[model samples]
Structures are given as structure tokens and as C-alpha cells.
Target: MPPQTREVVVQKNVPATMRDGTTLFSNVYRPAEGGPYPVLLTRLPYGKDIPSYTTFLDPVRADGSGYIVVVQDVRGRFASGGEFEPFASEYEDGHDTVEWAARLPGADGRVGMFGLSYYGKTQWQAAVTKPPSLLSMVPGITWGNHLNGAQMRGGAYELGTIYSWAVTTIAPDILFRRYRDDPQQLGRKLPELVAAIDTLQAGGGYDVLPLTKLPDPDGLTPFVREGFERGVDDGWWEQLNIDGRYGNVSAVTLHIGGWYDIFLGETLRQYAAMKEVAERRGTAPPRLLVGPWTHGNFGSTLGELDFGIGSSGILLNYRGDLADYHLRFFDATLKGREEALADRPPVEVFVMGENRWRGYEEWPPPGAREEVWHLSGGGSLTREAPSGEPDAYDYDPKDPVPTLGGSILMPQIYRAGARDQSPNEERPDVLCYTSRPLEHDYTVLGPVWVRLFAASSAPDTDFVARLVDVHPDGRAIGIADGIIRASARESYPEPGVISPTAPSPIKPGEVYEYRIDLWATGNTFRAGHRIRLEVTSSSFPRWDRNLNTGESGARSSRTEVAHQRIFHDPDHPSSLTLTTVEG
Candidate 1:
């Protein structure tokens, strides 16, 4: 740590020219009396002046800690000059900006990046370019592949996240930029847009028919329409995807993810990829830290449960805050003080239910074994496979299952994270298979998946699986969940991998096996607590409802009621698989 805090100087609208002659602007914060210092850079589409963007690590504080901080507005945003195309310009621009920042006055030729969400993505984009000045990064709550979890997941369009993001966040900026010079048009259109945003936040616009043509009357967000209309196998998503390009990233990384974050799967995938590359090249291994957090909420309490104050990013288990961790990491990687990170563990995860932090050398803790729990008759989950009749449920797209709690991003009305599922269980459309109270503590520390054997009356449909922790008091709290579109089930050949192929719709009333990737979770169900599994057809708005007509939800709004049958007989045993670690 720095012996004392230094006085800071601020420079606003510092310009950095990209290769295409487009100039991006950044706010520079530096120590007043420092001869030289390593630079920490973050480029984001969100305005650099916004306090929320810097909540992860304030530029002024970082400057006081003897680091020059640069917060840049990416091209086509705020102070940058260019047309805004999301995820299109970051690669080359990030490369140019890093070289420019390294040459700034009173700066050593070293640059490290840090940010959460889209800014985090900017870091990955920059690293993949192999910038000479880029050495380290902390990517929090970000995705590696745009198709897998960012834009779409399990072959279903991320309607809730994409729609809410465009309408509530992106549209306003485009509207402002369009009418900034014409006050008359701005005055006429601003109120209407505000009303639309308000209505959407209050859970209104999501139900609009022909999802491709969501109520964007002013045509502010054309990308939203294009995104919806594009098929899952479209070549468009491959341009920005970082799936097979991880080996190109040479920067030492410290990945930060949340169990309930929208991009949790990709975060883990990035870390695993980097770790593998490091091992192959005999380089330093990347570190990881996961907490029981939602997308924007890093607090102790999420939807209903409180994991304890130690879970907060502000003060993690009496260790310093997230900023402190970043400072130490930069000090080690950029400033050549490797000893600064000697005390920190490579992997630190917050296990819920146990409500505590645990450290290990790696993820998926060594010695963990996969355990299978079979679905049995009379709504029971057991270890033994038994003969039983298939359970049936009627799924009507007209009254699809409401988006309950789990890993979801939407407007404020729809909360994410673990919430009580008792009310949803009462609905006939949801099939519940619960295990009896555990005799001992059951600890699950890694990936969670469900293999379903079922048939539907419709040509195509969706299957949703949710793992719940049932308290002795009858509270069913969601842990992890996943969904698989029947037509694209083959696209996901294994966990954490999505290879979109031509859609193959199943024959009506034909039983097929589907694998639902529930992602991963770290939790310990205490003795006397029961485990539950929920099977449903739809999670509306969160994911666009599968119309059961073998048609894209983006183009068609035709509704169909499908009779679903779940098999658990000796020949067709559906089961839930969990990665279990000894307590």
C-alpha cells in the first residue's frame, strides 16, 4: 500500500485517437506530485461522469493510491465521436487507447484495466488484441461469448435482459443524440419516451406481440429488432464472440463473478480458458472470486436471503473491499510487487446456506464427485430408479409461468436472485419433485444439471428445471435454474458449451432426452432441509415464451396449449446431477 494518500489532479475530455480517425475522450485522474505511475484504464459506453460507473473503484481514490486512472467514453457514447455500434468498435479502439494512455505524462509504460459488466467486456476485447502496454485486468460480471449467455442462452433469446437494456438504458441516449440540436423535436419526443420507459419498468412493454417489433415507435433502437429477428444460428453473433479466441488474451486476469449474475457461466468459462492457456504456456495462473450476488447488487442481501455482511463487496470478510483487492492485484501484476498478492488465495467462493467464504487452489474444488438424484413417482426425488407413470401438466402459452427468481436481468419490478417458490409451486403448470429432509448436510459446490425425458403435444416447446432448497418451515428458495428449447437441444452438446446447429423440431408425442444446464452454485443444505426440483414449460419475459408452434417468438405470437409428459420409469429415468463435495 502507498505510505500516504497523494493529492489528485483531474483532466476532463482527454482525447485518444483511434486507427479509423475517430477520437474517444476520457477523464484522467493522477497524483499531483508523482514522477511516474502505472495507469489503470476503463472504457465504457456509460458516461464517465456517472458515479455509478466508478462505484467499483473511484478514480480519485485510485489516483491517491499512486495510480493514474483513465475513464474513457467509448466511441459513439457521451464525449466520443462516432456512430455507436455496440461491441463493434471496442477491439481496435481499446488497442489504440491503451498505447495512448501509456504515453501520457508522468506515467510508466504499463496499463491495467478494471470494471464490471460492459466495461469488463472492453478489457477482454483489449486483451485479445495483444496490446503491448496491457498487462492485467479485473473483469467482473462479464461474458466471454455474446451468443451463449449475453444475447441468447440455451437457444432462447434473452428477451428480458435485451429488451429492458435497450428500452431503459440504450434508447434514451440515442434519442438524446438524435434530437440534441433540435429542441422542438426533443421537447415533443422526450416525454413520450420517458412514459414508455416508465411503463416498461412497471412491467408493460414485455407483452407486446411480434417481439421483433417491440413498441419502438420512434425507431431509436434498430439493433433490438435486428437482434430479435436473427436466428440462433445466425453468423452475426460470431463476429463479437470470444469463444475460440481466448488463447489470444495474454493479460493476467482476476475474474470476479456472482452466482446469480446473468453472465456467470461465461465468467467461469473465461477463467477456465485462461487458466488452461497459462498452464500450457507456463505462465501465471488467473485468480477467481465468486459471491452470492446479482447483476447490479453485490450486497449481503439479495431477494430474500441474507448471506451476511461478509458477502458484501465493500468489506469482504474483514479483508479489504473490491477496490482494495484491485489495487493489490495491480500492484502485483503491473508494479512488479508480486509479494502483494502472496497472501491471497487463487479461488475464493462464498457458499450460501453455509453463508461463509471458502478458499481453494482452483474452482470445482478437487475431489468433488457428481451425484445423480432420480425423479420418482408421487413427486419424489430419490437415489434409486423405479418404475413409475409419467407425470403430466398442461402448458398454455397464453398464461405462461411468471418469471420467478433466479439468474435473470429485467426491470426493477422483476427481482433476481433466490426468492421463495412456494406460490409458484401451487400452480398446476409447474411439476414439483422434492426429496425428503436430509439426514446430514448436503454440500453442492459446482455445476448443476438436469436430464429430462419427456414428450410434448406440440411440435416444439421449452423445458425449465430449477433446483430449490426447501426449509423445514416450508419455504422453497430457488438455488439454480436452466432452460432448454426442444428444437435446439442438440446445440448444447455438453455443459458450458453452445454450438448452434440447424433447428430440429421433435415429433409431437415423441419422447426425447434433453439436458438442461442449470449453471453452477455453491450451497450446503443443512440437516432436515429438503431438496426440490421444479419442471416448467415457460418463464415468460425473462426468456421469450416458446409459443409451442415451432415458430420464433420474434416473428409469431400464435399461442398453443401443450400437454407435457415427464417420464421417470425404469427405461426413461430423468434425473438431476449435482457436483457434491464432502462437508
Candidate 2:
């Protein structure tokens, strides 16, 4: 660390005009004495001055780190002009903003972008435009596909997330837009809106059937409803997929993610795709950093368990703050300095249970072996398949499996990461298979998958698979989980459908193989610990329950109970595959 050598200057509400003649506003921070310096930009819908908007890095610290920092309000936000249509105006508007920042008075013609979540998304959108001055970007906990990871995961709607976010975060802006001119009317309506959002967050109003109709009579968040109305995944949603256009990006990227992040799956995909693109172009490979954290909190404790003192990113094994590390990274990429990352590894991850950070030259860390554990009789999880009959369970949409905790982006009422699964496991609808206590310490540090041969009485149903670690005292903590709707079983982007709008129906007694992606995990199960897997039909609130009807979406009010049979016989061996890391 060094002392400040130059006077700090601040400029407020600087306007940048887009190609469409709409003006977006920003606040610039710079060193008054410096002739020119690399510019750092953050574009977001949240107000530029909102200090608590992101947990990743601070703009004031970034400005003090000897760079010109520009924080802008994206189109249709606080100080900007234009109607806000999420993901529609970002590409062109972001491109125009980056180019504008490059020409700022203290800017050195090299531009770098940084932020997390929605701001992270803006960086990816901007990069696709291929601005020559944009040098590097650091995107934290963002998605590769809007339809898949951001909006829905494994063909399940993010019900609680969409509802909470739309009401609490986006509705206020919408209200302001509708009543900006009438102060008296706006004051009168704002309290009613606040009360409505409060009721929704407090857990009473979420049970509203037919998701398209919310706010009682009419929908307040039209965008949230629009997502539900889209029956088929097409190129329309793919237009927001940054991973598909990675070849067009020339900037070196640093992808930072959390182990318990809702976007972890997509974040890893983005890093891998960018790495391939960099290799093809003969440029520096993309770097990845993952820590034990939720969407907002990055600390030793999440939910009920405290990992350890070393788990916090700020105090990570005596390393300096994460913000300082990011400053060093920018120094290397934007200023061409070699002191920061001269000996740094390409990938850094925190292993839970062990509570230690490990660095690797590549993702998956090489030499990881895939081991399959079959679902056997007597609720046993073993390497050998059973010779008996299949296990059957009844799933009622009226009473779906309650979501406990594990990588959720819903309301704060449902905390994320590593909570006890006893409440959920107690339900008869959830079938559990537990492994005997391991004789040796086993490390699983990569992607986890569950392959199931199942049949549903209903034409359309849902399948959920969860991976858990069972402690000696009988605590089952959820590690990771995934879901697959029967309609989207055959393929992704374009699912197998009987008609253009409706998904194909499953024969009542026929068996079909389903793959459930549990995403990636970095954990070390101790010798005394037991590995557990739970099979169920739904994770309510986190994902909307399938009403067991041959309908396109949850818009249908008709519901039916589904009889689900999971086959584990020799003919159809259902198994859980773990990526084991061997030293």
C-alpha cells in the first residue's frame, strides 16, 4: 500500500449521449494532479451513489487506487432518460458509454469495467460490442444465459426471486415513473405500494395461483409475467447470452463467483467459454476465483453454520481485503504491471469443510475421477445396483417439498447456503438414500450429477435431486441441488414438445432417463461423514410446483397428484456421480 500523492476530484451528473440521442448520467472520480490514468467504469440501474449496491468492491477505494472511476446510471434509471427495458438497451448503451469514458479528461485511453450481479451483466453486454479502448473486465456472480441461470434453472421458474425482486427492487422505480409529476398523489400511493411489498416479503401473499396475475387484480411487474408467458426457449432469449458471443470479445476477463451463488453454474460456463476463445485467439487465458459466499454476504458464516475465521474474503488466510486484490489485478491488466499476478494461479477456490483456499492452473484441477454410486435397496447408497423393485412416492402439487437452503436468490427470509435439511428430509414425498460412513477422507471438487430412470403418472412433472452431507449426530446439510421438468427432458433451448406450445407427454407406466445437474461443489467429506442424496418432485417457492397437468406453464389452475417411481433395478440403474479429486 502507498500514500495518496494526488488530489482527489469529483464531478457529478456528467451526461453521456447515446447513439439514439438519449442522455445517460454518471459521476466521475479522478486524481486532479494526474495527467491521464486508466479508466474504471461501472454501469448499473441502481443509483451511482448507492454505496451498498454491491459487496464486491468499493468505487471510492478504486478511485483512490489511482484510476479514473466512472459510475453511471444505466438507461431508464435515476438520472438517465429512456424507458427501462431490461437487457434490451444495454449492448448499444454500454458500448456508447465505454467509448465515452475513454475520452474523459483524465482517462488514458484504456478502459476497464468492474461490478457484481446486474452491473456484472452490463460489462458482458458492453464487451460484445468490441470497443477498442475497453481493455479488461471483472464480472462477479453474473450469468451466461438469461433464460437458464438468471431467470430459470433446469426448466424451473425462479418463483420467489422473481416475485421478491420485482416488487421490492424494481417496483419503486416503476412507481416513480408513473407518479413523478404528481407529488401529492405519489406520496399517497407510495405507502400503499410499500405495504403491498411488505406483505409479499412477509410470506402471506406468495401463494397466489396463476403467476401471471399478481398484485391481486392486475400484475405490477409485467416483465416477471412476460418470463412466465414464454412457452418455448428460442433465439429470442439467446440474444442476451454473452457466452454465445465470446469469440467477439478480445478483453481479458477475471470471473469471480461464489460457491453458493445462484449463478455459479453459468459463471463457470462463462469462464470456460472465454478460456476457449482466448486460446483460439492466442491471448491470455481467463482467470476464475470462487469463494464460500451467498449472493450478498461473503463471510465465515452463512445460514446457521460458521465455516471458520479463514472463510471471509476480507480475512482470507491473512491475505489483504478482496477489494485490494482486485485493485492489484487491475494494475496488472490495465497498467501492464507484472508485480501483482506474476506468480498468481489461473483459478482459486475455497474448499468447504476444509475451510481453506486452493489455487490451480485450470478449472476441475485435472486428475479428477468420476465415481458412480447407485441407488440400492433398504435406502442404501452403494457402488452396486439393486436387483429388487423400483421405489415409488406420491407427489402432491398442493403440498410440494419445502425449500430449506442452498444457493437461493429469493427473499432474505429464506437464507442461502448449507442449512440443515432435516425439515425437508422428514417429508414422505422425499426419498433419501444414505451412504455408510466413509472409511477414508473423500474430496469431491468438481461438478456433481444424478442420472435417474423414472416414470410419472402425469404427463408433465418435476424431478429434484439434492446432495447432502450427513453428520454423525444426524444433521443433513444440503450442499447442492437441481431440478428438471419432464417437458424439458430431451433437450435444452428447445425442449421435446408434442405441439408448438405444449411439452410432450410421458406414458404413465413407461420409464424415461433424466439427468439432474447439481452444478459444481468444492467439499471434503470426513471419514466419519456420510454422503446422502434425496430425490423429490419439487423445491417449493425456490421453484414453482408443477401442477402435474400437460400444460405449458403454471398458468393452469387444474392440479393433479403424480405417482413417481424411481427405478434402481439392474435393468435401469439410477446413480449419483461424484467428481472425486485424488492427490
**C-alpha lDDT score of every prediction, in listed order:** 0.89, 0.82
lDDT of 1 by residue, 201-288 (tens): 8887888767876878488888898998887788888888888888998899999999988899888989999999999999999999
For model 2, the superposed segments whose C-alpha errors exceed 4 Å read 216-220, 493-502
Worst 10 residues of 2 by lDDT: 493-502
lDDT tens readout by residue for model 2, 212-234: 76572124467877887765455
Report the CA-based lDDT of candidate 1 relative to the real structure.
0.89
For model 2, what is the alpha-carbon lDDT of residue 448? 88
Model 1 worst lDDT run, 10 consecutive residues = 208-217
TM-score to true structure, per model: 0.98, 0.96
**RMSD vs true structure, all candidates:** 1.4, 2.5
> Which residue runs does candidate 1 get wrong by more than 4 Å?
1-5
Task: Choose the strongest candidate by lDDT.
Answer: 1
